[model samples]
Target: MVRKIAAAAIAALFVPVVQAAGWEKLWTFEHGAGTSVAGQTSEILAFDSLNNELWVAGLKGVDILNAATGSFVQHIDTTAFGELNSVAIRNGVAAFAIAAPIKTDAGSVLTYDTTSRSFQQSYLVGALPDMVTFTADGRIMTANEGEPLARPGFATIEARGSISIIDTTKDSVTTLGFSGYDGTTGLGRIVSPGAKPSIDWEPEYIALSKDGQFAMVTLQEANAVAKIDLMSQQIVSVTSLGLKDHSLPGNELDTTDRDLPGNVSVAGNYRNAPVFGMYMPDTIASYASGGKTYYITANEGDSRNLEDFVNGEFNEEVRVGSSSYVLDPTAFPDAAALKATSNLGRLTVTTSGGDLDGDGDYDQIHVFGGRSFSILDENGNQVFDSGNQLEALLFADPALRALIDDGRSDNKGVEPEGVTVLELGDRTLAFIGFERTRQSVIAIYDVTNPTAATFVDFIVDADSLSPEGLSAYEFGGKYFLAVANEVSGTTSLFSITPVPEPETYAMLLAGLGLIGLAARRRRG
Candidate 1:
């Protein structure tokens, strides 16, 4: 049975007046001077357990902070390395991915010795290494998002994305290319005709298996997940996360925020459209349950229309005629409703997935990410998806609903972006970050039972806006959660204590009763 925490209880505990929940806000620290160039700020976070410090990937360089108290310790300037994208720490060594300074499709990783507090080495990696993680066997893995920089007159100069594996013992780098996984014959290819599995697949984030034997990377644009065998250093499979049927009862999504004139609603115009919703996950995490390995993904969708959107090649208003699969009158009772009520704005389907039915019109319409998170089995089959559940929880409370305007419903509602899982005593908790929500929030859920995740609490701080990174650690017998707020240039810290189980409560009650009986006997 799934246990539900009452919304009233959560709201009451969240208020400044009370501290009823097990989560406590520790401190929030803004970066020095709290100013940086746009698009450059606190991008990622990692904790160095050996040094008892937290490393943050910031605009100018990496910032080191005291893990116990959110105080600044030191700043490691990395300007010479180029813009820093992510940071990872393991075995007293820290590594960060830096974009290339030149026009080449290549990036580099800088390693630092935490104990010595000095730069150790630098290694060239693939283009735009977006995220980095260390395996249990001391191998550094980086997800290189091989996104090409637009050059004039060059239609396709982009290099294919890849995963770079570094052996710390030998200081050697091995890159696994995605061009081979082009969805031709392997599980990487989607059945959807529109899926251009070859060139468009960009590896966004990666999650290592619990035992560290395998790594699963998310292809955000391709709506797929790739499993890599850490030992053999080969991509075993790439499985497409098929679409979610929004017309289904539990999968309804608010397709439009435009309600009738007089009503300024938070729920927006809810729709049960008969269309497939893409599960374009941004950040993914893995856990083991029931002797099975499961992965959780924060389905934050993305699209590529840099050239086409500017060239007027496609517009939301430019209807693909009545033959377009999106114009199913059965889904939208009124024929004109598609144009009038759709919150999809101006977006076009990619030309990759072939046109099914051969009617000279696109047979399917693909939208952005699922706007939620999902738990998938080791095979990439979804065990449970929080379809519109996050939106429903936020909207149910007027105060939380008002935190972010309803306009976001049109484009990636709430936008679940980052996720981190930690073991709290007997329970395993998953913390999900909302990136686009005006006031970002960390939604905590008890994922002990992956299929039946139950909402427990939400951590909201003034500085939590556009949370791009999350790191959790245990120090001095206490667990701590760190949030890297990109927009605010701040790192928010919180302490978490797991809720006691029913058995614990019962034992406490029985002990109290026994004490009372002993006191009565002594009196007699």
Candidate 2:
């Protein structure tokens, strides 16, 4: 406990904006900054295009702000409804997903007229609707997580994860569950010892298809994704996102939080290891490229320990070098030296699966996350993975070196949590938010080609921390990205300016040549 506290304290102590694009911080809004509810005012936000207002969801309620200036215009106290989870706006209407105080029970989607700030309609849905999104045609969808409340010596209430669809035109709701795969080996990754796949799979976020005919829900803990055919309201496929092989060259990672003598500067210890990481993505977004739909995910990992719950004591996580975990001598001939603290000893990994020969010893090591963002095909196959670049960039950048919590190196580096994409001219820019970093560190990538993507920049800001949600917009001839920081309870806006096109550069060179010729003529 003492070591854990000390580690937390140390972790707390810790942009290519000039190239492909330049960015500027426009304004920020603090939610309940001075009141008792300070630093607890936000989780998600949505922009009402028609009303030109941004609706922010927090514990207390919703805060309405001027999207143009980041000024608070009004507040709506929604405590009576329940715990607010997410907000989405479309046309002139806003939908708020509110989970019941007891999240295991049913939740509801409340719609409001953004123009009048008044309630319009309500539709009951599934439990713990963590994310709400709208199609361009006004179809509403929610990813109902249905998380379990666990305690020792007590019965756990396990609610099945589900997706809820609400048809605005029909004023009806349809909730879909994973009952068909409950008893089967359908959920690809880790599953709770005695829990069915239906209850074990928790939906974290939702991303819709371009044509509004399908939706993909992120089953984060399961390390899988479910494709829903919106036209049929059926879960067409559930694909396991597979694992990241750290043995590969570019997939290497910094494995420990070893600080120097004075703890004044954090040093990076990066290398390849005999391990694999489950791509348990928390957030995902879809885009169309070359007639193909590709999904981008921030590979944030998660683990659940049964010892911490009322379920059977089978912890999913254990230190790689722990006595309880054994490496098969046949697989790892040099296991002793590999167990060093600077090596894999201090690295935390999942223990649920790995015994290839059933000899009660692991032949492979599996960690929680990939520590990178991945671009996947419509079938959930990885087309491209960032691989070591996130950590490489962190150690490479002098400005971000101090912010690289060495404490997080042993676990998920930077902990890429939120993901959103924007269209800048001909380039598709992906912004990945790191939650575990000291402040706001957003990694931008140009993912024009699914097979080959390039890193654009790494943008950071002290005003934002632990960004839980991101929304990118283009209004008034400028592109802006809004970040909702959970820890700071602040919503920040940054305007993006892209680099000139090749044609523009050609024109400039031509004009410069003309000026040079005129100067020569004048000299003659």
Candidate 3:
């Protein structure tokens, strides 16, 4: 049966955002599906230019919908291909990345005809092909995560991470593997204990340059980015994304939420600490500025299997004040006091890092994720970091603060997990999604000035939860932002118009021939 938004809901569209930027909610489409991963029904979204529709990829299959109306069209079930991870559409073709029955085995990429909603062809790729995209010149690029897994009795099985490039004209595939960088060192690239760079590195996401000459691949576990020369089809460079110094004045973070005096679970005890944060970004987007390319990262942190703690295996996360945790007395003068719950003691740090010396004790404390968004140069140098901005913003707003999940306070706060860059008229803005928040809070920033990026406002929706994917596009003479809320299982559409300057607003008014002021539409 065709599921479409009711006429009443469609008529009540274009409601203006009350608190922040004047973005209006169009309609939210609920995808009633379940997956093995946290019951999430949506993970990624793709736009079909030829059909003018939205194809939302979930673990079960793909759900097609009318982009402008958020009305359901049809769902193409590809369950035989295994769990679908990502999808991309271009030139009327939709490509999906699917893992094999055994995730460790090789995966496949299947292409479908959007017009007919029929299967076109399939190509074999590397293990756990998680992300798929199409280049401007009609080529498919995939980031095969090749995650590491442990079997019964601690038997480790690993699949080497790689990038697969599909050339349709040539009917061939060229894989860019990390074998050469197996023992690679330096540049803040981390090799997990008892693992090589090839097996330890997992490619999480991919972004392309404006000119389509290069590609940026995010290695989340390695805390680095790999540059691929598309023209050469080779791995050009791997740059390490250095850690963020929380000891800096602007980089303050709240470590233990339930430990401080006068602290509610939603409260923050923001202070400087002897800790460094790894900018292990999840989703990345690239844009051009000043004839150079820059990448935007949503630094939502992750550890190696939180379930390992229950499985009696080596867990990567350890509390600073845990019984097994040992700090170098000399490196930290006030070791006993630092272990207190009000201090860094209750905070979780990665056990795989921070042992600067060969000694048993840790000389430094390293934590997962920057807990904020960041901008990096083409060479993977940090140009801007939203230091303590997200933590400060949520705490300052009572309405937003009331929706916080206290369970996440001991870890990453307002985890910025998804990001997309868009050119809305004269401004190049970045929309970042917080995956940890109960409410879908997409913070906007004016990144027109890359070096000195500033916050504009936030787009918050109470009906949404755990926004995992964000995509922006212009349709029917209007700009829109679509968010895929994983937890709520709803994909929401919002109409966004850039606030105009004084002269620009006057010019727009004169051009439209409006004699009296027109109030913007306000509805939910």
Which parts of model 1 are misplaced by more than 4 Å?
1-21, 32-40, 102-104, 153-156, 183-198, 262-266, 308-334, 342-355, 358-360, 502-524
Q: Which stretches of candidate 3 lie over 4 Å from their true place?
A: 1-21, 33-40, 261-266, 306-310, 502-523
lDDT score, candidate 2, position 297: 91
User: Candidate 3's residue-wise lDDT over 3-35, tens digit each?
Assistant: 111011011111111111347788888887432
In candidate 1, what are the lDDT values of residues 11-68, reduced to their tens digit?
A: 1112111111266777777785643333346769998888788888987888888877
Q: What are the lDDT scores of the predictions, listed in order?
A: 0.70, 0.78, 0.77
lDDT for residue 89 in candidate 1, whole number 0-100: 92
Write down the RMSD of all candidates, one decimal each: 8.4, 9.0, 8.6
Model 1's lDDT to the true fold? 0.70
Q: What's the count of clashing pairs in each model shown?
A: 5, 0, 0
TM-score of each: 0.84, 0.88, 0.89
The 10-residue segment of model 3 with minimum total lDDT is 2-11
